[model samples]
Target: MECCREPSCRKRGRWRWRWRRQSGSGVNAEEEHGIKKIILIGTPNVGKSMLFHRLTGIYATISNYPGTTVEVFRGRGSFENQLFEVIDTPGMYSLLPLTEEERVTRALLLAEHPEVLIHVIDARNLEKMLSLTLQLLEAELPVILVVNMMDEAETLGIDIDLAQLEKDLGIPVVATAASKGWGIELLRKRIAEYVRKHGVRKGVG
Candidate 1:
């Protein structure tokens, strides 16, 4: 019988899946209750590094691509009145590693098993950026999608329906102008919620 149609399989897997979701949430609370380690990820030049600095107040070297600097940075941030160890990873287009940096980025994602994985992307290029978002979900990472460069999107007459996007992805989607300090707090709150709801300490995924 097909897995979806199998009663016994559903009975066995449903609670296990629910329990895994709770595990992720628990990990978030664990951090609040004194846990650390969150990782930020995205494609190149999408503002992942900038967001890291904004959230952590520590600057990492930033530059343009094609002779651009692609390296990960580590920092710290607090949300929901709790501290966290935050890591900003190198830009990666996909998990099926293509470039050296992409391979490195994928390795980090697999090994770190971060409590929260923030996927920062260019809001103007949502169509293109979402490919990575889908891939993240495929990897079973606890991912939150951040649409960075909202200001630019507005200037270009590109309106992103964040609610609709969230519905499509079944994940929290936040629009941010990271450089201008917009949406950072809300982003923090959502991150905290996801962490509290999904982080393994809470018995979530």
Candidate 2:
């Protein structure tokens, strides 16, 4: 039985996705509800939705391989009195888009200019995923890397040297097993810190 046939199933890959901007926010993220926008970005099936669900308590299970997210979901989460408007974007491989979903995500980044981009990636596929991370940095977008699915990676005898990665990227990189709830709090802490450092609202001219 193909589970994706159902209306509620998340496996429809790169179809029926829509990008919408919120209304009534004239100010930057830090001022409005102290709402920092944390947009999730990565190639398909890198555990983006799983991290999204873990962060927001929203249920959105995505598929594997050609496993693009079919829709974009937004939700809010808070940590230590700081609130965030978390955005789960359609899965895209790189800053340079090849698909509609990729285009929409890249366009959203330029238009919305979110405070921080959480680029979730599989721990097992770090080398391939780092290219996008480099692109985000090149584009001067504030980004945080979430190295997810560590449990599976460990089982495969794959150990990532995160500190070395941080040194190389010049940005914060977090590890997690979103399915197991490991490294989530640390991710939140890093996010809160990133927002506090970078999400400061500028004075209106």
| TM-score of every model versus the real structure | 0.75, 0.77
lDDT of 1: 0.72
C-alpha RMSD by candidate, in order: 11.7, 10.2
Give one digit per residue, the lDDT tens place, for model 1 in 1-205.
Answer: 1123333232134223322333433344323334445778888899987899888886232222223355556566778876775778778888898987877677667655577889999988889989888988987788889999999999999988899989989999998999999999999999889877775432221
lDDT of 2 by residue, 53-160 (tens): 888776332332133444557766777678666778888987778887888787667655577889989999999988888888888888899999999999999989
Model 1 — which ten-residue stretch has the worst lDDT? 1-10
What count of clashes does model 2 give?
Answer: 0
Model 2: per-residue Cα lDDT at residue 186 = 96
lDDT of each: 0.72, 0.74
